[model samples]
Target: MFAEHLSAFLTHPVTATVLLVIGIVGITLELLFFSSGLLAAAGVVGFALYFLGFYLAGFVGFGDLAVFGIGIVLLILELVVPSFGILSVLGAICLFGGVLMAAADPKQAGIMLGIALLVAIIAVAVAVKYFRHRGVWNRFILKEQLTTDKGFTASPDRAFLVGMQGTSITPLRPAGTAEIQGERVDVVTDGGFIPAGRTIVVVMVEGTRVVVREIFEQNS
Candidate 1:
């Protein structure tokens, strides 16, 4: 029976290609790609493809088990634990081995890979739209910001920072630390280099945008 199945698999071109693609993508992406919305979707899709191909090739038991095992491990690693890369790799290895053992034909792998990728895209899109407007997102994002500072500088006539003097404390690789009004603040230079220990004069503070110029008050 095994020899007969091998002969049939060898004669099938499309089946072999699909299996190869699904197997390659399922294992490779699971291990190599970093965590992000797109990658997460891709990973699931790849696994689905691998499992489907496995079933079509007379490997039903192996294919279903592979899917279940990978799903559980991924859920744990993606949410429960802070760790990511290592567990993903382990799951991927299991996936690859499972597909190889169960699938009689290597070609159907490509077709399954496509199904997995598409599902991932749809899942991520739905998640983003649904979660974006929830108060949870707002609370999570703004918890660090102070309540009073949220809209204090709304009045344009009250721009009190126009003539402020500051000292550079960070290399400002164009965007670094500067001391203004006895407080350290993040500053940026537009095509201008401001080295550490330099004196800068605030020429304009137009609508939260601070324009500064280097002063040689000492060098002059």
Candidate 2:
């Protein structure tokens, strides 16, 4: 008795409509606004709930790999093909076919489509956030400089930091990694092995490398 009522409610257009609304809102916040990953997650959950509800009720199969596979192929064609609008036609065909096959029940199908849109929005948001904040550069997400690229600005000479006093955080066995004043650097020595947690002074900064000398004597 309870299970039948649940299925009937799941098939309700109003329930599916509410799910669609959630998906739309999630997508909107993700794409048009700067945000964290939470809003997008909410959107995905909203959609996923709908998909599961419909699939269990025999609406359509979200778990169908063939439908997904066809969609992917269409996506590939859209990227690689060079006709006037053949890619768009193929892509649309694939989408419609996959969607139609998965939608065994009209109400369930609607819910799954709604959720898919929501998932897309969240994916875009994550992609943008990851690319925007990463140290390395990617062309798609990096539209403008969020801030001035302030990092190890490379120089062409060795006399830049020749007199800066520093210490090695890592053992520099003539040629190893080290840090000076919380700034990590690749350094070499005069064939002298220096252990980590020791004091050294920068004698040269040549192109991506720094040369250091151990300091044992201090004015008292």
Candidate 3:
């Protein structure tokens, strides 16, 4: 009968370990590379087979499958929702718990799960480092470099505005706007207030900061 074959598969630790490893690694690959959901679908199928085998053989109950399903839901939510690893940790716990519950032997299941997790970690590290074409990773990372030739500057060179005469449009209570060289420039005074409409001269230009001093008119 189908149950006989299913029971045999679950009873053997080697085949069972292979199934768990394949399931975990498939999901891991899908998460890391996003292979158009192909890997994810395969991984889901692998887990479905695992649960189906155990359930059909009467080794695991519906509640065990429910826990596993909940774990899968939590892990999927982790991809969309930012929980700072809380969801992932909880999901992993449920996932491992469900697997152990379904297994013929809890101790063997734990050992196999540990092996699967270790393999998955090593695989991810190798893929990230050696693999050049990261499917969805490219979309998240900005590989383009902004250079001067691309008309990008950290700050505009305002040195040309030095020695230019202008009038303060706002009270430069040490920092205000002034019209320099026919352009409105944000200039700061040398620790002195210059009221609006006062004549000011640009004394220094340091990066984006334009230093200005007010000019006093001479009267007879």
Clashes of each: 16, 2, 0
| Runs in model 2 lying further than 4 Å from the true structure | 62-101, 105-220
Q: Model 2 residue 165 lDDT?
A: 70
Q: In candidate 3, which residue pairs get closer than 3 Å at backbone N, Cα or C atoms, i.e. clash?
A: none
**Could you give candidate 3's per-residue lDDT for residues 32-97 as a string of tens digits?**
676776876776777777777777777888889889889888878866784766887787788778
* All-Cα superposition RMSD per candidate: 12.0, 13.2, 2.8
Best by lDDT: 3
* Candidate 1 residue-wise lDDT at 34: 34
Candidates' TM-scores?
A: 0.32, 0.34, 0.84
Off by over 4 Å in 3: 132-142, 148-154
**For model 2, what is the error of residue 130's alpha carbon versus the real structure, in angstroms, after optimal superposition?**
25
Higher-scoring candidate on TM-score, 2 or 3: 3
Judging by lDDT, tell me the better candidate of 1 and 3: 3
